[model samples]
Target: MQSPAAPATPATPATPATPAGNAGGIDPIVALPARALSQEIHARRLSSREVMTAYLDHIARVNPAVNAIVALRERDELLKEADACDAALAQGRPAGWLHGMPQAPKDLAATRGIRTTLGSPIFRDNVPAADAIVVGRARAAGAVLIGKTNTPEFGLGSHTFNPVYGATRNPYDTSRSAGGSSGGAAAALATRMLPVADGSDFGGSLRNPAGFCNVYGMRPSAGRVPYGPGPELFLPQLGCEGPMARTVADLALLLATQSGADPRAPQALPGDPELAALTPASVEAALAADLKGKRVAWLGDWNGYLPMEAGILALCEDALKAFPAFGVDVEAITPPFSPERLWQIWLTHRHFLVGHNLLPHYRNPTRRALLKPEAIWEIEGALKLSATDLHAASVERSAWYQALLGVFARFDYIAVPTAQVFPFDVNETWPKQIAGRAMDTYHRWMEVVCPWTLSGCPVISLPVGFGAQGLPMGMQLIGRPRGDLAVLRLARAYEQERDWVGQHPPRALL
Candidate 1:
């Protein structure tokens, strides 16, 4: 999988001219995608402080070459909350379906007084007195938080570097790797800097940084996006928290505003309790989900027990052979358990939930050298597990979830490849090897996103293109175990047959 280095012609960056009242007057308002700039900020024709000062002037021209909006917050307190959302749209009132937009969240999402750094240096000057029911449902669906992003520490790793806000990179190519525990929300929605962000996954941190920053995340369907305060008998759906954008209708308008039902989240997912009132025609009916005659299996590398990197399985096999020329059948197949039994039931349920959530930072001996030797080998490998190795990994995860519900009762969708190698070298922290094999652990080069994070089901990464070092390459999909809106209508029918989120990365990372 390591063949990349030959393609260099991208360096884009020279547009800095359109300032006076920006937003949907577009002019690179970070290439407009949050549902067409939320219908031009709900047809007030854009003036939530001109789309929050054109996303703080495109994060001061591309967030210092992709650090991915780390702690941010005060741009005069986000232009006085976009001037109280343009005086609540000049008192005609009723606005919020992400009304004024401008979010950030996902420094492990907790934001009330903001500064919630889970990119840990002992929560680096913490904060968060509240919020985090998906940031209070993305601020009751009006968005506008404006800071946080970057992660890794408590979000263990996919690679968004951390010791309290450090590495993010890869806006197609800063040095590489944008993938992580939502690598700064997939490098801040791949350079849009934040139109829609928020993320979390477990073994692919929101599908390997939305396939290493091309964009589109979604890990859903484990009680469809709910999350909570702490470990109330953890490990039910091997970690979740969703949404990241650059389209699939702005990731189903931030997954219908981070989904619903949260009696302090006892496995959440009550969703469609009017999906906590998300509108814009239910996000254009979950972005016109179609996929023609639907069938689709195409499991790119699992049969080889995943070593991948033949140029990311030839750009996920040219996007599953362009979904059988869009009539959609596809079908390469390979899922009845064994990427060594889904990596031993994802390393005994993710190292016993990373040793009960970081064994109090490895028994705090001065925060034990700020953890991370793969969190002290997953907290001493879940203190050497063995309840007969978690009942033989819970009887091989219930016969690998009834052999993936018998391959979704004859395949309606499975797919794979959200990353096995493409965006490496952000000063290298993981991938000790891919094509030549060897990576024994440090997230075994992401066991093809830990078998859909142990198949709680509903996955998604998207972006399928570019790789001979020109970077980007996504894929994944999965669905049908609750099938979060049938895996977002087959990823909005292969994102309306490959719009690839309207391309855009090399405006020189700006």
Candidate 2:
């Protein structure tokens, strides 16, 4: 495996942690949640090397079962880097909050000197000269980049599989999928192989995987986290990079690290001036938040417009009962925009963006052969679109945004199932049908997540618990546009009120 280049300037590490203390009885550092782990490292309770070694050992023992992490750096190299962190800590230099943590970014993200295959064989040996914005921010925050997490080919699907690293199996059910683009990251977080992970979302790449793996993943508002230090900065802003974690607090901390504007990304959203006071204990809004009498609209199956599998919607509905218990009023209300319009808007944007994004490779006969069928489909569909089609879709998209704004005027949050179906068989490429409704497109089964994507709002996927078949599912809590912190706080409150967030999956228990 290729080792990423060291940081241009070394970050001063925090005060040295005692490597031998297990006073809390959590001797194995891998067992700690990211928030607790971060605090322990900076408070001198655990050394960077100790955390790195524990993680390495755990990864060796567990990663083979699910194949969540790939292109891992050799053990000696990582330990040596951890040692450097410890040495710098002794010198009394304080690093960023993520000082001693280990992170494996999604495969779609480029890492300096490390292979970033994008789940395609074409880039199997491609080593990048620089990191993507997500990876660079994490590095600047003092995280040790261990390697890349798995994703579908070019991150085109929601199931993590590519010729490069193969499919990532669900940690809870090895025969089932872990969900994708961010699938591998979710699996890694669920199994305790990574303290936290990062991923991107276009059509629920971040949400689906987290739900399938029974972890937390958020798709922050578009531009909130800046998509790139790459070309194509403009147009196709449907997807944005965001954080994934075992808990909401860790998600907030990561969001803070990943947020903030960059001149390189001209369309990026500005950082919150009030974010300086953020803490893991309370991932709240600037003003104090109150749940009393807050209105939440549940768009369950879009009022039967969406064909969800039998058990998925029930799980989401049951999860909503907790909100009302907290003085929140939950209502089953249909959005003013029909499901078909939302699907059309989502499809149009995908065709335009994905077509332009992948046309270069498709134009090359050899490269085109390596592209996935879905990639080809997106490109061809895009070619069939005209400037008129895009204009009409863009116009409709603005109306859809207004429709959502109207919903927000009456509701505090919008709710939906994160996925139409639970984790399917690992060998199957995608669900061909949901609740007997034939899926017309490769991503049709995921239409449930597209509304939030099209709206460019902040949505968090929370575990709704396992289905009758024992496979896990997730519920989406959609907050207002650019309301990243509000949705995060709601998820934080849900994590505390409900008992689902910390329940370990099968692998974590073992």
Candidate 3:
């Protein structure tokens, strides 16, 4: 583990940002964690123009290799915005922690005026008139909307690629993938193209990419971050927007800004009053939670019911040691509920939500022809679901929720593998097989994250370490429902112990 990168001035055009190794060449400002970077900007130790100029220069140099950030805004306009933030700050009116920071929302997040293509040629010229709720929050907080991150078409797959912007390659190895629909977000954060990013997760969109990239990402409890003010928020609970950053403290602070209640999102969870108490200055202390006597259930591979690539679980088990070292009890436990049943419940809900949402697109013959097979599959499967099937699946989902509550009664957290396989070839679509077993669906390879997804629990992907091939992997520290902050605290504790901070940068970039 490496010590957290210290804050430094923005790199000059001549300064080499990525050199031979993880430690030496990273630009000082690019190396700083988002929280620390925020402090530098807010305190005026670094002017917004300085901060923005450095990032623009960094992105110009770094983003092309990975293709993580797309549709970059005009450089001059962004610097002008940064100057405005500086002006407001000089007037004692700092917008917030993100003032002057460059952030690229995932392509799925609609940005007003700026192109918001969902990685599809069908909407390549499409630009929303208004910002998506998540994008709006970041803009309001003073983040410079530098550009949009690339994502899969319709944000449909765990891998981030689309016909429009190509694929967002893994920064650790450009030959491999960056997982998605939030893959661009994770990749950008890993390479320091963006200080913090917003992403969405229905399946493993958030966790898988974070794991593959060796960064921190969270799929907050359903409604914890109000994914919408969306057209169909009332129906979808499986997917939600989340925060991703290089460090836990950065992740938590970004989560604080993105979370809160909105009248439009009726099912959104109430904001945590405890979260209100968190400031960038005190985030480290807030996250340094004492884990003495806390109990964790390590449900690896779901008792071998789910297949995994070689060395994946071993890496996870090794990381789990951080818990016991904190005086938290780590027990390997298998749930009494059938893993297959839970998977079915997950598939049913996922198909229903995805299908219904894309029905309008599917209905048009010309548009349907433009749809990817995965999107077509989801809608077709959804069409087969009768109200009775929907009702039965809903009942099973409820049963699993109750079943999960029983497990939570005994343990404060459950740890699981964030991804079953490591980063695969960037050009390949999805993993068709794992450990010699065929994946029946495009997403079955990601089933490890499904059970937790079904529970709608707050799950954070903790950067455990790298695999034999040098690809990074993460462990899912899943908290009880609505236990968003608890999960962060535990993730922070594990991160602190691993000391896996400053040193372990993307070697490919370095």
Query: lDDT (CA) for every model shown?
Result: 0.76, 0.83, 0.85
TM-score of candidate 3 on Cα atoms, chains taken together: 0.95
Per-residue lDDT over 1-510 for candidate 1, one digit per residue giving the tens place of the 0 to 100 score: 111122134322122222222322334655677777777777788878888887888788778887888788778888998889889877877456678888888888788897987888888998978887888888877878888888878888788888677888877678877878878878877667677887888887888888777778888878778887665624546888888787776777678778877788877767774344556656666446446777877777766777887667666666665565556776676557667777878888888877767788788788978787888888888999978988888888888888888988887878778878888889888889987879988888888778777768888889886666567768888878876776776777677767654644543352
Among residues 3 or more apart in sequence or in different chains, the pairs in candidate 1 whose N, CA or C atoms overlap within 3 Å are 1-309, 13-507, 13-508, 98-141
Task: List clashing residue pairs in candidate 3.
Answer: 1-499, 19-510, 158-180, 180-183
Question: What local lDDT does model 1 show for residue 283?
Answer: 68
TM-scores, all models, native as reference:
0.34, 0.93, 0.95
The model with the greatest TM-score is: 3
C-alpha RMSD of candidate 2: 9.6
Q: RMSD for each model, in Å, please?
A: 20.5, 9.6, 6.1
lDDT of 2: 0.83
Candidate 2 has a TM-score of: 0.93
Model 1 global lDDT (CA atoms, 0 to 1): 0.76
lDDT per residue as tens, model 2, 253-297: 888889989998999889985553565444434323677877788
